[model samples]
Target: MQTIPAGNYLIVFNENGVREINNLIERNRYSSIFLICDENSHEHCVPAFLSEIETEIKIEIIEIEAGEELKNITTCVDIWSTLAEMGADRKSLIINVGGGVISDIGGFIAATFKRGIDFINVPTTLLAMVDASVGGKNGVDLGHLKNQI
Candidate 1:
């Protein structure tokens, strides 16, 4: 098990890291749990994650379209709306599962919702594992401009 200390959190890299996730959830006792997945992660990674994480806590899944094009304020609004509709409170945790796009957008959603909430990144791609999931950099493009605040 490899663990990298990132700011206040520990990024554990292991085939069985879902156990860590379970432990974190149990330890934190979050009020609600949310899983944000892109279309690709929903189809490819969600099953594996679910199988590995053994938790009685109910989890709500939010699926978004996969692609950089969909990473924007619109998508963030949708995620925030869903979280609100699902009764997510300040103690809710958001698990982002997918590649860079999912992590970036999902992290943004989690960070902005309820003035910020706990979030974990489950990067499912090499690009995300190497870059997006490490730095905690999250943002969306503004129209045709990339990463335009």
Candidate 2:
């Protein structure tokens, strides 16, 4: 029931957050919805996430492999390509549903795609809630280097 305002978005709790998200969707009139999650979240979190969203617009699930090694430019490129192939445009909204890797990479893709589309970070872990989702630092690693893109 708690709501924390973050810029244009409100970081809310549980199923209650979905209501505010629906309000956002109504206000934005996004052409489509992109739910970006890793394998773990897709399996665990996405079912609950999808059930609460009340929208007529098509929702696409973009599931990525779960691992730090997968959080690189190559993966970003693949996802970007997927977004394009799936008809993602400037009016699309990307909802990142997972922890750090998903928040970081998915946010990065949303920020850069079509010169930045709107995105929401639904951090499902303490690390993501305190760090990645709030950090506003998005980019990918170059091998062992962090955030080097």
Candidate 3:
């Protein structure tokens, strides 16, 4: 397996990465688990992910519409609200599955919610796999502009 260290976490590649995920989850003993996925990843990747995770942890899947247009403060608010409703505390873990949009916004939500929770990104597209899913950078656009601070 290819392991690229990114800050506190490792960006792992290869089929064995699933085993790595299981190991991380087991080691962390997170209070709860939340998965963020766009429509594409929800359909394409969640099943494979679910199969790979051997532990029977209670996982809540959050789905957002797939598109850059949905990446905004409104989406973040919805995600934050969902986490609150689902009782996600400081010890919860957020797994972001999908392309760059899911990873970026999911990371943002995880970082801000409950004053920061642990999150991992599983990129499902070439662009995201190469760029957005690694390096721990995440942000949303400001209206028509892109990557606005």
Candidate 4:
């Protein structure tokens, strides 16, 4: 896979995305792996995602409710607390695997928790895939307004 450098992270392409994800897992030695997904993605995307990843590090699945209605400060706080309770540290890695809601909230959680940890988005839907492929767009809605928080 060809890695296109983007700021502090790298985007893997030109090969099987999942295979590259496996390679990345092999390369990094994280203390723990956190896979954050909505309930839907947890059912549809996670099995394949878990199978492709060959990591011995414990993977904690943090499943959240889907939809924009859930993408708020409440959800962020819940996920933040969950990360703390799940033993996430500075060296821990977060993998967001779901749609736009996952990408937005997941990135926000990863960026804020513990003064920022590493996170990679494995977007499931077409909208999410397009959204995650780009860099540096992360925020949760503030009430009815989008990207407000």
Candidate 5:
């Protein structure tokens, strides 16, 4: 496992980690829950995640094209547009549930929407789990440059 910088995050490790997700959501009691994922992740992981959250909480799943090329301002615009169309407001919580590209772009969209909202990262790929999401590092790539904030 990668080491997240000290005091920047709260680490929780469990064999049944997904179970913790629902409990975490309950504890925070966000107004709404939005799940961000790629097409592949939607097909592969989303069902299981949804199954874990048996609560009656409002949940919105947003799926984008799975690729590094899709990580950009345009994608953020699309996600924000979706959020608007879905009636997602500042109180909604964004849960990123894919690889690095999805997490990076989704986090950016959530961070900027309505001057920022709550977000959680559930990275499926090894690279994302090992590197990207763990460090509080986030942002989409700009042409040849990988930007993080």
Candidate 6:
């Protein structure tokens, strides 16, 4: 199991990591919590998450179009708009439930919404679980652009 330590933050990892999301949320006293997922994750993970979380906190699910191409400024705009419409605020917490694309875009969206918010990565893919999710490097790649700016 891996532990993500950042300032006052501590996240534990394990096979049943997904099951503990709600408890962790409660412990943190997050004012609001939502799940941001792509089509694939909505189908593959949501049901299991729903079964495990036992809380009265309203759980909002926001599903965006699934694909690497959908990870961009436009996608963030759409998600941010939706969050606004749903009355999400600075105290809100976002749980990203997908692969690298979702984690990156969701992190960016949460980062910008109401200036900033808390985000947890519930990465579903092997690449995300092993690499992208742990590195803390999040941003959409500029199309047709060189790595060096």
- Measured by TM-score, the strongest candidate is 1
Candidate 2 lDDT over 1-149, as tens digits, reads: 78778776566766477788899999999999999999999999999989988999989999989989999999999999999999999999999999999999999999999999999988889999988988467878899998896
- Over 38-139, each residue of candidate 3 has an lDDT whose tens digit, in order, gives 988999899988887867779999999999998898899999999999999999999999998998899888888988999988888999888788887888
Expressed as tens digits, the lDDT of each residue in 23-142 for candidate 4 is 777787789999999999999989988987877887899999888899999999999999999899998999999999999889999889999998888888998877753686899989
Off by over 4 Å in 4: none
Candidate 5 Cα misplacement greater than 4 A, ranges: 1-8
lDDT of predicted model 1: 0.89
Q: Model 4, residue 32: displacement in angstroms?
A: 0.5
- Report the C-alpha lDDT of model 5 over 68-119, residue by residue, as the tens digit: 8788777888889999888888888899999889878877887789998888
Return the lDDT, model 1, position 149.
42
lDDT of 2: 0.90
How many clashing residue pairs appear in each of the predictions shown?
0, 0, 0, 0, 0, 0
Preferred candidate (TM-score higher): 4 or 6:
4
How should the candidates be ordered by TM-score, best one leading?
A: 1, 3, 4, 2, 5, 6
Better of 1 and 4 by lDDT: 1
> What TM-score would candidate 1 get against the native?
0.95
User: Model 6 reaches what TM-score against the true structure?
Assistant: 0.87
Candidate 3 lDDT (Cα, 0 to 1): 0.88
Query: What lDDT does each candidate get?
Result: 0.89, 0.90, 0.88, 0.87, 0.81, 0.79
Question: Model 1 off-target regions past 4 Å?
Answer: none
